[model samples]
Target: MLNNVAAVLLDGVHPFELGVVCEVFGLDRGDEGLPVYDFAVASAEGPTLGTHAGFTVSTPYGLDRLEAADLVVVPAGSTFATRDYPPELLASLRRVVDRGARVLSVCSGVFVLGAAGLLDGRRCAVHWQHADELARQYPRAVVEPDVLYVDADPVITSAGTAAGIDACLHIVRKEQGPEVANSIARRMVVPPHRDGGQAQYIERPLPRSRCDTVGEVLVWMERHLDEEVTVEQLAARAHMSPRTFARRFQQETGTTPYRWLLRQRVLLAQRLLEATDETMEVIADRAGFGNAAALRHQFVRSVGTTPQGYRRTFRGSQAA
Candidate 1:
């Protein structure tokens, strides 16, 4: 359904994020019988676009190609939170979206989509650094910070950098089939699917000035995800009172210590579910959730999908 795709390249675009869109959708592997895309990179005003590295990229097509695309990709651009988006490009993006085609955004591109008003009522995901800015700009958008990507019906948004691959693969899986997506991923030499969301990569809070202490504490938490870790225990490692620790910890990291620990535990559960043949109850226990029901509740709350269902849908069909 989405064989025709377009990637909108804005000025100050990061090369790798633009390359991710090209890697996933612009490759022509005709021998594999994959659905080759009608892919082209277009500028906002038919001019040579500048990248973050101070280089210019010339494009053949302009904003008009986006109107004909079944799927439009907005790749990451630098300083999107600080930059001004062209009104004409914004209008063209809105017009295509109004016609019912899907719009996919990578990293800070969510800011551009938000500027265009397409992300008004939708749930969105962005680079962790820009999450607060996006929330500030579009208070109406349900901002998801726990996941690498958020698929809100037709408009899909991904967090920074490598998450763009996952987002694009999700689109391929949804439009064509799991089989085709797996093929593309294999050709790309990455995992056919990533197991968890952005939980594992989230930075934790530590009050201490010593960097090694924080690392030791985090290692302990990750290894013992199956057990309850009170703030007091973590505080003992840092040798600080609970009250002072909580306050300073918040300053060191953007999130609370408890929330960071809980998300990692959930991601651990995700790995076992996706890669192992273990039962849900056993996986739940290993992930610190006492029962399958608890695991299901948390998994759905954070990931928008069930454990068994996610595994079945993205489990290693490439192995087959």
Candidate 2:
């Protein structure tokens, strides 16, 4: 049902974000039995728009092209966070959603959605750098700062660059099937699905210290994900008191030790689920979850999907 797609652009649009939308929805993948969208690039400012990369893009399509789209994408721009959108473009977006079509924003493009009044009372995801500003600008919108994407139906929002790919594939997976989304991902040479959120990508400013004591512990922790180690034990390994170690870990990593361990374990489980045909119990033990039930609980909490479901989706795509 999601056949027609259009990317509406403004001046100073980030080429990568525009390319993300184009790559996902503009290509004719029907050769591989994948759905082919009737795609176009629409210019909100004019027929010719300059990108932040010091190049110009000319499109035959304009805002009028959006009327036929089942999905309209607003790709990120350099000044989108502060720029004013054309009233006509914003009105078109509102009408598109009003008529049951979906609209999606990649990174800073979300600010445009906020301008269109589409984000009111909806949970949205944006690049972490823009999350606070977006929340301040659109006080009614719930800004999730650390997620890859948020699907508030009809108005999906994604975090920076690569997150747009995830959101686009998610839309494909939701509308078409895992097979189609996976096939597209295979062609793209990206993962069909990624575990976890943007928290890991955020740059935490560690304290200016003479030694990176926590970094050493992180390396050890990564290597021994299957090992059960208490914070007290890890603190001992770091040659610091448990309280000091905990504080240092939080300061350096922006998360507590338990959360960091849990996230790492979940990531390990995801990789295992995708790559190995191991039983749930085996994976649970290997990922330090101890049992399938624990793995399922933590996996569901972190990845938002059951291990079995994740495996099925992953393997299904690989099979395709």
Candidate 3:
């Protein structure tokens, strides 16, 4: 369990994501028997600074405070694709990390981690829109495109802004176990454990049908992720022809049925990979991958890393 926390703020800090760091680690949850961190909002500049939302936050410390911190968090900011990060900030980040402190980023803050050189030759995750730019910016860093987050041992990054909450929950689960994490989630009104490596699949707008077309089909498919679910079966369940069902599913969800199912299966596979000591073959069977080879192929294709690699990376990042 970490006792110290430091958050490095950028010029255009996204208020919500930064608030996540404040709420999760910076706040005192000790009344609930959870460990409370001595947290500080850190920057290279003054304690009083500006946010992207056109307001000022009263930070109490600077980057030097991170020297004694156990975890360093970077929240979302604007101008990630083109702007250069302050060199001093990057240097201080590297220095603290070199001393063995864990580093974390949410959303576009992955850009700052990349800029700090912490992502060199490391497997990482980021918001999808910025994944290409992160890869292009740091050629050596392996970017996981669709995951909620990726933990490359001492460095961790999350997807879009809200996914930061998921990443922080993962850290809590790692340090305090599933029960404590669940308690915190109940208090926060979010999922208890959304394994760090799960995909960030936002549900698309579906047709507002007078009939239960897409809704029924979605529920049926979720209940039967393991069973062989054919398009024909879905069509039959929806009482529509196979051709029409496929057409309507795509029109509603913006993706093919098979692709969405594969993503969900991949998410289940990642959870089993992280939470269980099961072998790849067993995890493959349970997660509907048929075999370890199939699981690896799809996992590497979708997450930019093998299942074992993802597990190792995330397990190696804790108390962050």
Candidate 4:
């Protein structure tokens, strides 16, 4: 089992990402009958290192602490994408992996594993903002830009800030079972597992040119996900031809109307599954799928797992 854990820190590390590791592994959750890891924070820079938020974190443990850890986590640093990692740190990471232990990275920390050559010929996940740079820097590594995380077994890499929580919980679920992971997530007040990929979150994050051409139509579509409306109907609502409305919708939303609506429906179904004890048929109707069978097909297609399987993983078998 994963009894020992270590978080290897470098200067300019993001505190929230580091906190994700500490919260999931370092805390004494024995009261909840969960495993209490033998956890430590090791500094690669020195006894004290500065953070990107204009603060400093001091730790007595050093690289030697990583030797006994079953899992080593590298949280993101502000400059990790461009900065060179210490040879000693890279060597320690490779040593742990060589010993059959695992190494996980949060966000830009994936660059450290890339530098250690661990990611060579492996598929990895990174924050969408840095995905291009990661690919440009490590040509041999396959970078997946839009997934919450990738489990390449010995090396797990995750996307942005919140994705770190998903990765850590995933590790718990994989090693300790769904019950422990779900209990911890309940205490943390976050979902035990998230559905869909980061692709859903990345669509049209930036604001369009203030013209608000299709803003009203987009809002209407969001409120009426259950309705089977065509582009012609949406065009009538927007007072434009079907062709012009479709083109403008694509330009403004960075996705087609049908695709966007489908993604939204999937997202809604995920929330209902996590937060409520709803039946599949009910959830399907509420999320625009019409029936359990249709919901199951679309849910598995979009989330890589069946509805019941996902509910069981996140909510435990009794709840499922």
Q: Write the per-residue lDDT of candidate 2 for residues 1-320, one digit (tens) a residue.
A: 89999999999999999999999998888887888889999999888999999999999999899999999999999888887889999999999999999999999999999999999999999998998999999999999998889989999999999889989998987676656777899999987754325352634444465364587888799899999999999998888999999988877766788988898898788778877888899999999999999999999987678988888876785432
Which residue runs does candidate 1 get wrong by more than 4 Å? 195-320
Worst 10 residues of 3 by lDDT: 311-320
User: What is the clash count for each candidate, in the order shown?
Assistant: 0, 0, 0, 0
- TM per prediction: 0.65, 0.68, 0.68, 0.67
TM-score of candidate 1 versus the correct structure, residues matched by position: 0.65
Over 1-320, each residue of candidate 4 has an lDDT whose tens digit, in order, gives 79999999999999999999999998999987999999999999999999999999999999999999999999999989989989999999999999999999999999999999999999999998999999999999999997889988899999989889989998887777656887899989987665324442544554464454788887799799888889999989988899998977876655788888887798678777877899999999999999999999998987679989888876799989
| TM value for model 3 | 0.68
Weakest 10 consecutive residues, lDDT, candidate 1? Answer: 198-207
Worst 10 residues of 2 by lDDT: 195-204
lDDT scores of the candidates, listed in order: 0.81, 0.87, 0.80, 0.88
Question: TM-score of model 4 relative to the true fold?
Answer: 0.67
lDDT value, residue 289 of candidate 1? 91
* TM-score-better candidate, 2 vs 4: 2
Q: Who is ahead in lDDT, 3 or 4?
A: 4
